[model samples]
Target: MDHVIKTLTPAARPPEAPGEVPAAPLRARPSRAEAEAAVRVLLGYIGDDPDREGLVDTPRRVVSAYDELFGGYHENPGEVLERTFSEIGTYDDIVLVRDIPFASHCEHHMMPFVGRAHVGYLPVERVVGLSKIARLIDIFAKRLQTQERLSSMIVTEIDTVLKPRGVAVMLEAEHTCMSMRGVQKAGSRTITTQFTGVFRDDPKEQFRFVSLVRNGIG
Candidate 1:
């Protein structure tokens, strides 16, 4: 199947010198009550009584769940990576974190797709905490997204913020939209990987990263 690759620019920084594009305005979100009402409408549209004993509180519960599910919108990926440690000058090698679990709703069907993310980065001058890499994945996964776009976004965020020498990320997921509906192929899985800089230039390093991911080691 043909895949779409979107090339993203580096993270935007506040204008310090001059001639920078100002940040776009943020849109106001609907109130919780409105969101709950919308959910009820959707539940009713699907031929379920929103007022039924079992589902009476489902709308409110769904809205509350969304606060955590789609919370990536309210976060800043740049800020999550702002504090970096360059304490080691000569320690330049690959840093890989494997098997980070994540769950996300597909943009196309709004159904959940669960997965594990494996991330690796080659430090230029410094490195970030291992958990920060997992947090980065969480930031991107909690939004409605395609697995392809999600993989790209993770690499782009790390590339933009850490400014590493090279970065690599891989994600393998089982999309519920396929398993629970439509074609209903229960065991089908999608995998996406990205590499940058040296990881992209040198096949050996790319192979090494892939090997580490396969072996579940740093």
Candidate 2:
């Protein structure tokens, strides 16, 4: 129940907010062969024998691993929410999908932060599929991210595409950068939450959401 709650990057603008400029498409940087070459260079720089029989294929493996690690670049969050249904009859209260587990790379160190997400939205008229919420989380999680940016991006994507009456997101993650290196505080976790519309404007609604996310905890 105890965790750190601070933005990893303070000066950068939040990923949400009306009129925020869309992120420019990232240009192609290196081909797989080029990436493998770079990995080989790194192995050499680290004083490893790149051509040693045991290490010769490492560069190729690393490149293949990166393709999966950073695949969020190819995903469009809006598209995932496009499949929705409005068939819920008079069921317009909070729709929550909790304990959605995910992993993401920290943009600063390219290390991993693993966590579970709690996402909830007050429906206006339309509601997206439950699995779509999990898939939405996955799409964003596959990218290099700061937890701050990641949480905002999730809420923004749901609100923008689903036209939800409100959105609430809570993410609790353990950053490997802190646990494996840097300060090296293993087991330290980070908790972050964001809200928009009714979840932000109404305290009772916010409290209800928090309680639900924490599973009725006060």
**Overall local distance difference test of candidate 2:** 0.84
Query: Model 1, 67-94: lDDT tens per residue?
Result: 8998776566656676778788698999
lDDT scores in order: 0.82, 0.84
> How high is each candidate's TM-score?
0.85, 0.88
Against the true structure, candidate 1 has what lDDT? 0.82
Evaluate model 1: give its TM-score. 0.85
TM-score result, candidate 2: 0.88
Best by lDDT: 2
Give stretches of model 1 more than 4 Å off: 1-27, 216-218
What lDDT score is found at residue 205 in candidate 2?
88
